[model samples]
Target: MRHIIAVLLENEAGALSRVAGLFSARGYNIESLTVAPTDDPTLSRMTLVTTGNDEIVEQIKKQLNKLIDTVKLLDLSEGPHIEREMMMVKVRAEREDREELKRLTDIFRAKIIDVTDTSYVIELTGASRKLDAFIDTLPGGAIIEVVRSGPTGIARGEKGLVL
Candidate 1:
């Protein structure tokens, strides 16, 4: 099963490296990871996506909790949560295809952040499925590049992870 694990850790050097090293040492795959400083400058929040069975997930949680930098940890997948990923796709938008590209952008509610005579850069944020759908609908051989921020999520309701 896929699990989205939220981790609060000390915003100090080597914190990220230690977490990544732990995963590498255990031979576990991380599908996506997003980390940034939270409201507190002394801490960072990491949203990690991984797939494994219940037993493996449990092991992952236990190992993570053992990290010295870990301040709090939560498996957001255990509760109601929202996930979003941001992507920037550059497409070959020639004169004849500009109209169609604009229409598609409007349909997806994506923004044309940059444009040139032969290309357009679009910015979009939404669920992973939605982003994939947008990419699937693009004209064949029109995509120049795509950059994704991966999935970051938060739990619903008033409760949250804090140090």
Candidate 2:
């Protein structure tokens, strides 16, 4: 099964490397990873998506909790949460095609962050499924480059996931 694990850790040098090394040493593949500072600058949060069996998932979580810098770990698969990812896509556009592209971008609720004679850079944020759908709708030969910030999520409601 696929699992999404959210880890809160101290904002210290090598912290991300350590978390990544753990997965590498165990031969576990991280499908997606997004890390950023939390409201409190002293800490950072990472959302990691991976696939594994029940036992393997449990073991990985256990080991992750053992990391000295880990402040919290939440298995979002078991909780109610709001998950989102952001993508910035640059696409080639001709003057005639620009209107159509803008229409599609508006439909996806994506913003044109930059525009030039030949290309437009669009910023989009939403659930992974929504982002994928938006990407699929682009015109053939339109995409010039893409940058994605992998999924970042937070549990919904007053209840917090950290323990």
In order, what lDDT does every prediction score?
A: 0.94, 0.91
lDDT by residue for model 1 (1-163), tens: 9999999999999999999999999988899888999999999999899999999999999999999999999999999999899999999999889999999999999999999999999999998899999999999999999999989998999997886
Give the winner by lDDT.
1
If scored against the real structure, what TM-score would every candidate get? Answer: 0.97, 0.94
Worst 10 residues of 2 by lDDT: 154-163
- Model 1 vs. true fold: TM: 0.97
Top-TM-score structure, candidate number: 1
Given candidate 1, what's the lDDT at residue 80? Answer: 97
Runs of candidate 2 with Cα error greater than 4 angstroms are: none
lDDT of model number 2 = 0.91
lDDT of 2 by residue, 5-81 (tens): 99999999999999999999998878998888888899998999989999999998999999999999999887788
- What is the alpha-carbon RMSD of candidate 2 to the true structure? 1.3
TM-score of 2: 0.94
